[model samples]
Target: MSPTIRSLVIPVTDLAAAKAVYTALLGAPHTDESYYVGYNVDGFEVSLNPSGDTAGPVAFADVDDLDAARESLLAAGATEQSAPRKVAPEARVCVLADGDGNPIGLRGR
Candidate 1:
């Protein structure tokens, strides 16, 4: 299944600072939680993750079938960084690394 990027996640050392900056920049309110802070700007989802790596921002793609998408990416020279894990009752996510070690995220419901 083809996947479309739907979310952009940014790792931050300070959640509050990041949230404030993003909120002002996006001019949108955010859902504040202990682990994550999220905002919907225009048609894009922007999130601040406290537990994410500092390497760079990760773009999460929505796929119809998570498993199939993971397999397809792996076969295309991507390495699995994390296995599928449930984020919500009916939603799951996974992470993969390209040959250059850039992280990519996949989400499915």
Candidate 2:
């Protein structure tokens, strides 16, 4: 926790082509799917998603309490771009936007 960015999701247009490039750079992915390709590098997650809103990669800050952390961001004038959604068992992620429209990703339970 401690506001660390341990997860980052990169948006790619071509899944297969991106996979090949990422695999060459980061080795093989641990989780591969039609929509997602995830690589684990010493506990840091580097994932690829073709459906991300931004053209650039999104770095997700790992938080201890998702609801509280999200609320705090909203209270500080951040806009909620995406609601809390579960990605896995006890794992959830959401997208928020700052005043300048920069996407802020949060991932945790």
Candidate 3:
């Protein structure tokens, strides 16, 4: 199964400041912010995670089969940051680092 990027959780230190910037950039306030600030713009869902020292960009993708996706990524030379683990009752997530230490999170049920 191929993976499709479903959402991106950008780590931002300043929630208020970043919200304002994103609001201007997206032309509206985030659609959802109570649980986690999320802005749906141009067919992309940008989620703002209120923690982390994210120095750069990160990508999160959704896969139909998490095990297969993880295997493919490993075969493609990605290094595991975290093995697949259930974060919810019916879902699992994993993370890997690419050649340049860029993180990519994988999610599936």
Candidate 4:
């Protein structure tokens, strides 16, 4: 299945500060949470993560099948950074690295 880039996960040192910045930029209040802060702009989702581990933003593709998408990307020269993991009851996500070592995330529900 063709994937669509519909989400972006940004690692921030301070969740509150990031939320304020993103809220002002997107002109919408973010869904605040202890683990993640999310903003819905139009149809795209922007998430602020407080893990402080990511080097940069990770763009997430919306896929119909998480396993299939991971397999396809791996076969197409991407290296799996992480296996599929459940984020919610019905949502799963995986992380991979492209040829240039950029992190890419895949999300399926």
Candidate 5:
């Protein structure tokens, strides 16, 4: 299954500050903003989640076959963090970390 980037979530301590930076970086006013803001850009979605802890980004994607995708990653030297699990009617996903410990997600509807 060929995967495509779906969303990128950035945890932020100050939503307004982060929004300003990202808005300028993207060079466009936010497409959507609320207490929880979401931006749909270039077939990739950007979202900001508020938190007090240090921020980090999470990359999400679409996969035709999540199970097969996970297997392929393992074969290619990725370590599984969580086995695939259903998220109910909406979708399913699995978690893995590459050799460098960056998270990689496998997801399907």
Candidate 6:
């Protein structure tokens, strides 16, 4: 199994239209809301957000220990982009910028 989230959060302008296209490819979403839509494709997550950031896709890595993972990445030269935020009852997420400033997300319990 992949240790990473295998998750991609795409920014879209037209949520409805984008949802249509993605739904056709990945089928129904498990979590559908106006701001975000999420689908699980064989354990891989493909999420869509209709925010006009235009920053492109962000990938998240699933970690058992978010704090440890964040510390490890920080020690390895990654800079924190966003602090951990709880999105669900069992999930929390944060973003870190790699050497090139690319966003890397960490998701965990």
- Model 1, residue 8: distance off in Å is 0.3
Candidate achieving higher TM-score, 5 or 6: 6
Error of 5 at 44 (Å): 1.4
Please identify which of the two predictions, 1 or 5, would achieve the higher lDDT against the true structure: 1
The lDDT, on a scale of 0 to 1, for candidate 5 is: 0.73
What lDDT does each candidate get? Answer: 0.87, 0.91, 0.77, 0.87, 0.73, 0.88
Those runs of model 2 whose alpha carbons end farther than 4 Å from true positions after fitting are: none
Off by over 4 Å in 4: none
The pairs that clash in candidate 3 are none
Query: What TM-score does structure 4 among the candidates reach?
Result: 0.89
Report the lDDT tens digits of candidate 6 across residue range 9-77: 888999999999999999999999998899999888999989745377889899988898999999999
Whole-model alpha-carbon lDDT for candidate 4: 0.87
Which 10 consecutive residues of model 6 have the lowest summed lDDT?
A: 1-10
Please rank every candidate by TM-score, starting with the best.
Answer: 2, 1, 4, 6, 3, 5
Model 3 lowest lDDT segment of ten? 49-58
**Backbone atom clashes (below 3 Å) for every candidate:** 0, 0, 0, 0, 0, 1
Q: Residue 27 in candidate 3 has what lDDT?
A: 67
What local lDDT score does residue 15 receive in model 5, on the 0 to 100 scale? 82
Residue 100 CA error for candidate 4 (Å)?
0.8
- What local lDDT score does residue 25 receive in model 2, on the 0 to 100 scale? 95
Give the runs in model 1 whose Cα sits over 4 Å from its true position. none
Model 2 / residue 35 / CA error / Å: 2.1
Error of 6 at 16 (Å): 1.2
